[model samples]
Target: MILSWRKKRAARRAAKKQNLEVTSNMELTIPSHFRCPISLELMKDPVTLSTGITYDRDSIEKWIEAGNSICPVTNQVLRSFEPVPNHTLRMMIQDWCVEKRSYGIERIPTPRIPISSYEVSEILSGIQTAKDQQDAERCREMVLKIKELAKDSERNKRCISANGTGGVLAAAFKTFSKVPFEQNVALLEEILSALITISPLDGEAKSYLGSDSSLHCMVWFLKNGNLSGRRNSVLALIEIVSSDQQKIDELLEIGGAIEALVKLMKEPISPSTTKASLLLMYHIVSNPPSSANSKVIARLTEMELVKILFEMLVDCEKSICEKALGVLDEVCSYDEGMEKAYGNALTVPVLVKKLLRISDLATQFSVSILWKLCKNDKSEGGDVLVEALQLGAFQKLLLLLQVGSTDGTKEKTTELMKLMNVYRDRAECTDSLDFKNLKRSY
Candidate 1:
């Protein structure tokens, strides 16, 4: 009995010690910026490569061992494998660890240098040789290699990008874009995945990729490619078109281009992709020569894009919702846009819900949209007014007056309220206690 008791006591002590270790690790608050970009942890031995990115030596060395020539952060090719020891950064990290010891952060031990640059160069050369030859096997290898390398660090991204990975991929895309579909489709999918991995091509790469042929190829891919390909293609176009008004015009000019992008907005793609598509549309619709804007707006309406925007308002980030609202505000300024918005059943209710504490900008856009809808004195306006009353928009307006919305929003909301009064006979306007209290409070 005494021996069993002692065994249990010993087990409990060991478990308690393990639990303490976990608790200490959990309580340590390592600042994200202090972490090694690759490992995302406190750097014991931080080393800066030629590309000027500091990574934990172990993580970066392992990355090099895996046959990657490019820096992970910048996606630029590493000129040399040599990573200079960042002594000052190490000391600062050590000091921080020591200073935070009371807060349960353990001191990071000094890190030792692991491998020489010669080994890294050997691995890189082999990978480059494999990539240079148009060997299908080698191209497949390059795809995964580039994808993993791009995932390591931001500095490595700059390195890969600067070192011409995008150009390499773009060159491959040019070659594969022409080949027979059955033969090259899989390889092209791999290339597209790699491109998606290192997306938002830098300015220099974007400049090279903004060709008419590139734009055409992307549109084709969007039309025919698989789900991943389509999403990546849209993101690639966003980078390619960027802020150049001419490129935006060129993108819209491609056949099925506007429709393809609008379709992407409604598709089951990730939120980020959807937001990117929206941003691209915003660029085209938010500012352009009025002639171009009119054409784009017409295309958007024809594609039923307004309904998609309303669907997005149901659950999206504040920033994304704000951008969508901004686009809605611009689109609804047109007669066709207003008709489309008013025609959608969910439009007014979604806008009304968002007005209740969604951001200041969102509220402004909602008010603008409501104002435009209410400005029409016909039955359409009366219908919207009735919906607003049913949705408690009247209470929201009174609250807005009390909370002091922006001059424009307040003015529009007040105008909407007056219009509601004008149309009260057409629709049974609610005069609930909240409405009465809001009016008195205002």
Candidate 2:
């Protein structure tokens, strides 16, 4: 009996010790460095930022993808979006996971980036060689490969773009301009697709692209290429010229850039493509034109841009309406653009309907457009006023005053009301206005 009791006690003590060991293991604290700054959890894939801070790749990528330019840990602007993988830190985390596996920690495998720096550099070097050797087939294959790489992931897109992809491709374009446009459709499409995959092209790339050959190449794609090619060209132009007046003038000097853009807008392949064209138009026309570009405004008039834009304002959703009105407002700032807007039968009604109905931005643009049309109408004793009064614009302007608006918008509203004060009794109108609890983030 004594021997059996001793054996039972020994077994009970062993079980208690094992339980204590398990409890201690569960209480082990994760090191600060092992934890991601963003998630405050053990990192699965560690990467070092240019700011010299480490974060989990997933966390940092999510931050970057959200359009943040600053590092979360350092609170400093990230010089480069590229995050170098910290293999050592990742391994350390993996080892810790293994050590705690009995406590339910799972070891993570090695994480892969979209592409390595070496791979990107090699492809770029090959592209340069193909361009120099005038190997059209080799160049096409190389560029298509790049497009495929860009499509792999956003990280790959940034990786290839951050390298010399744009410069080399620009050089390729300079060479390929000698090729007949019809023959190089696939090649040009691939090039633009690759560039577009990494949009907001860096300054170096933009400078490289801001040349006669590049502009004319995109113009050809815009005018003559297939639907996909056309959309890609316009999107490429938006990233290329952006708001640079000099580049805009150069693109204009290329002759068919504006015409091709306008034509695409008229016969759009899709809503997204049409929206892209509108953005490009806004970028080009909104910027101050160079002294040598006197015919820019007249060209817009000749293209019937005002009617087209008003039509877009009439049919498009709130997002597109805002873009269309933004471009239309800029176009109407000039005498020629104003002449086009004036001739449009739906101009006043559409502008009035857009007010307070879309967004503060749309309403502001509509107000400016209305003010211009009204001022332009002063010669006819404000036909714009009569139309605006008929469309209940007077009540909307009053609402703008009551709800409050930007100083410029308010001033324009007051002026419009004053201009139309004499015509208020001429037309019967309803004062009903519902904001629908519309919220604006701007």
| Best-performing candidate as measured by TM-score | 2
Tell me the spans in candidate 2 whose CA falls farther than 4 Å from its real position: 1-56, 60-113, 179-182, 287-294, 378-381, 431-442
For candidate 2, the TM-score is 0.74
**RMSD after CA superposition, every candidate:** 9.5, 8.8
lDDT of each: 0.75, 0.80
- Candidate 2 per-residue lDDT, tens place, 87-180, comes to 9999888998898776667899887666877998899888889878877788889888888888877778877877878777866776676546
Model 1 clashing-pair count: 26
Q: Where's the lowest-lDDT run of ten residues in candidate 2?
A: 433-442
| Residue 251 in model 1: lDDT | 82
Clashes of each: 26, 0
lDDT against true structure, model 2: 0.80
Residue 223 of candidate 1: its Cα lDDT?
82
Task: Give the runs in model 1 whose Cα sits over 4 Å from its true position.
Answer: 1-43, 46-140, 162-192, 289-292, 315-320, 404-407, 424-442
